[model samples]
Target: MMQKEWTTCFPFLNQMPDDERRRFLQSAVPHQLYAGEVVVREHSKCVGVVFVLSGELKVYKVSESGREVALYSVFPGEAALLTVNCMVAQETPVADVSLAAMQESLIAIIPSSAFFYLYSVSPQLQQFIFSCMYKKFNAIIDLVEKMTFKNVSERLYEYIRENTGSGRIPLYTTHAQLAARLGTSREVVTRCLKKMQRAGFLQTERGKISLLEKPEP
Candidate 1:
């Protein structure tokens, strides 16, 4: 990516001191990730600070049964902060914590050594990193709360409602994929979806689920 394009994704670079910004941009490595590619594997050493320029990245964990449970997604203008903790500590992640491209994506990475240097000297970089990390942390916390306190059916309803936003909306994900995102089995998701369908809440077709009407209180 051109320097201009990179700057456009991370506008905070404009606020950084010239020398610091220059060093950071000079060290960054851009990579193109294809859909379904696993960019970072579980229990590995930190890759670096990943900057998503476009498309999406999914952060997930693999259970012993080989089921993948999604933690969250990183989109354009966002960074996957899970790596930040590992990067700063110079240690492998404690959890399975893996990252995969949810779709074709462009990402720029600052190597761990360069990141530490830039983070120390550039307050703007520090602020930007921490701000992103804080937001992602809050999202993870909310996900945890829901997973712990809500049943699969309730979570499924909320997921559909939240994604629907307003009006009938089509979601382009398979039952297995929704199961992964909601930390459940495909059969469970399918049953819950069938129940919802019977209740006039949604309609399911191959590779798609569409909201039909809002659930009553």
Candidate 2:
């Protein structure tokens, strides 16, 4: 996106002080990424703050056996806290999480020093950080609960319901992606998905899956 478009997405940038705004703009580098591109790899240190200006990003965790569980996703207008965490804490952040482009994406990269400076001086930015952090924390906690307590079928059902909210939109994803998000094998997900298709809970065709009806309580 152009400077005008980026500023429009973040209107507060127009209100920032001259020096602060200059520093912010100077540090905010742009990156264009393709689908499946990993933004932050497992065990890698933060280079800078990353936020999506367009498209989507999937942040996930991988297990020892090569399974993956989604942490959360960063969409247009959402700021990722991974790099921010590193800047604020000073201590080394965990590198187990990976952030990848879910589709064609436009990301703005901000320097850590500039991020810290703005974080200290801009109340609006600070408020935004706090709000984003709170949300990210709750999501991680929910993921932990699912991993610990929910059975695979139950988790798969939950994932389907959550992603295809209101049951109107067909889930635009593949079995492999679902398996990665669920931290299970593709065969396991495919088996269960086939079972779901037979049971009238869902239908799969091509690359998308659509929920058929709400499950019984």
Cα TM-score per model: 0.92, 0.87
What is the Cα-based TM-score of model 2?
0.87
lDDT of 2 by residue, 28-110 (tens): 88999999999888778887888788998988878887778788888776788876765555566645578899899999998
Top-TM-score candidate index: 1
The Cα RMSD of model 1 versus the native structure comes to: 1.9
Error of 1 at 14 (Å): 1.0
lDDT of 1 at 169: 68
Weakest lDDT window of 10 consecutive positions for candidate 2: 87-96
User: Please, what are the lDDT tens digits per residue for candidate 1 over residues 91-204?
Assistant: 544325899998899988888889888888888888888788787888789899999999999999889877777436678888988999999999999999999999988888
RMSD of each: 1.9, 2.4
